[model samples]
Target: MKTRIATAVLAAALLTACARDPQPASLPPAPSATSTATSTAVAEPCASVITRMSERERLAQLLVVGVDPADPDAAVRLVREQQVGGVFIGGNATALLRNNALDAVQHAARWGVSIAVDEEGGRVQRIDELDGTLPSARTMARTKTVDQVRAAGRERGAQLRARGVTVDFAPSLDVSSQPDDGPIGDRSFSSDPAVVRAYGLAFAAGLRDAGITPVFKHFPGHGHAEGDSHAGQVTTPALASLRTVDLVPYQDVAGFDGGAVMVGHLTVPGLTDGVPASLSPAAYRLLREDYHFTGPVLTDDLGAMKAITGTYRLPDAVLHALLAGADQALWSSGGNVSAVLDRLQQAVDSGELPATRVTDALGRILPAKHACG
Candidate 1:
């Protein structure tokens, strides 16, 4: 048990490290069919709903705050007092996840709170103790055919769905052949771009088929990158290197029905200009304009990740992501909910994070969470 976990810890070191500035401003072909349905098409009642919300609530809605998983009441307090839009159960904090643990949190909210977890099988699962263990992404990819992989994903997604979880952060899209102990390692499906694409989409489809919102992560790509973002900033090959390899899987990303995206904090040469992608507008442009991904976009864990923390404070880090075009900023360490929200509120008033951006973000967020009540 120790060996498997330790191996996975090293293996899953950091499969999420791809966000750089941008190389070009060119727009890709028309977004895929599903891409057209992104929150940008939001209309009517939801817009009115946003107007009715308080500045604090509006800002809170864009946040997916991490919370203490041992104390169910802590989640309730966040929703009732701070009115946060979502609560994340990070690490192995399972005490609050049992027996409808999140029901109370939802009941306390006017909109609703999204309960999320890293049930990425292999190394990064939060429900292993409760749900039976599953193999890692690499193992499944090597042994299972695409159909079999989809079925496996469905089985696992069903287990997660039964536990009242709405989001599953899985099906890492990074392309890599780094050592099994490297940052991405076995967490990635394969080093070959085609194998990664077929099996990756199949697994994600399985999760979505089971009614779970799978989050395709670590864009523009983290595989083959240097180091782990958890320890410090990471760098990826130049944009030219990624054009043929890492970015291929994302070209057909419109296939991930009812899914979301998690950008990395990678420094790309022609793109991010040395800063992490999470805070770089150029990076967001690459995703939104180049990749044509209009779904709800989230930053990697800002509250805890060193790639982001070593520079900006939590509040500033989140603000930069929002200003840069990310719809939501996630911090899974779960502290200072009030302080973050206060900072966001101040930004809106001071014109740092304009009210229009807040509303534009909500157009994407409220629909994704079904929180427009």
Candidate 2:
């Protein structure tokens, strides 16, 4: 009986040892140092890719041309030929169209291109058919709390990101003092600069949290402007007025890290001798010097916007935008993209547009691309 007890005890000890030894399936293997290093090595290519890009390729990286969702083939062609840095999904963007366009563009380009959309919620939203609409900017400002606005931004960003969109041209910081203002009426968050500043920051933060980039629009204040830039040149209030009211929100968000600002087409007579801010060196100077914004500065659409096209053709307007310190010259109509590329390359070759300008633009752009990725 003692011998039998000893054998039973030994069996129990064996059972305990088995229980102490965890099954392989229960514990995930820790990543080895070599594997971790390999994963990091894979991500280092974008830097080298940027370094090896030719001058023309570098210039192309500054262009974010629009693409019609109906014409996916054309977008593919544009990516293959023009080597544009990004494509903004334009015109009635349904889920199918957005997915198709993304697939085509992503397949064509050797490097990934930033696929962006105007999903600013409310009336400015471009992909509402695929992603349901949120309240207008004015409505949200009047009714929604800062947290509510931020949550809306996250929802908007998730919808876009789900369809492979990376950038959101949104959260207009223009403070609409005049509710009846023709261009920015319903689009502006509030007449109060503080409200606008708070909501804008919240909305931007939400987009960043969702892994999407947000671009603040109509810099130096389009809220006070008289007319729509798409129709014709609009004029903003004097610089003093802008400083007090219009420029306040921008100054508040100027230090934003992962955000970009879109210079408007308004003719700021006070700051820039009646030059549209998008093409005016003085306007850009105010943003860069006074506001201390070092992030990417994009121009409002250069294509067919009477504010620019009325004065300069597509190619010339692109050149002016680049010369004026705009990083990405957006043509939202999907015009002859190759022609614009050819013209930019020619300008670079002729020394009309300095290569340093391209490099400077890339300095702002590539980091944003890497961040979004």
- Clashes per prediction? 5, 0
lDDT of each residue in 1-373, candidate 2, tens digit only: 0001122332343234223322233221211111110011123445566677887788889899876565667778888887888887655535335544577677777666778776665556666666577777788888989999999888888777777788888888888865533467777788999999999888988888898989988888888788877788889888988999988898766678789988989888677677788887778878877888877889887764677766676776777778877888987666556677788889878877777677667767777877224
Q: Against the unseen true structure, what C-alpha lDDT does each candidate score?
A: 0.76, 0.73
For all predicted structures, in order, the TM-scores are 0.88, 0.84
Over 4 Å off, model 1: 1-41
| Model 2 segments more than 4 A misplaced | 1-47, 93-101, 178-181, 371-373
Best by lDDT: 1
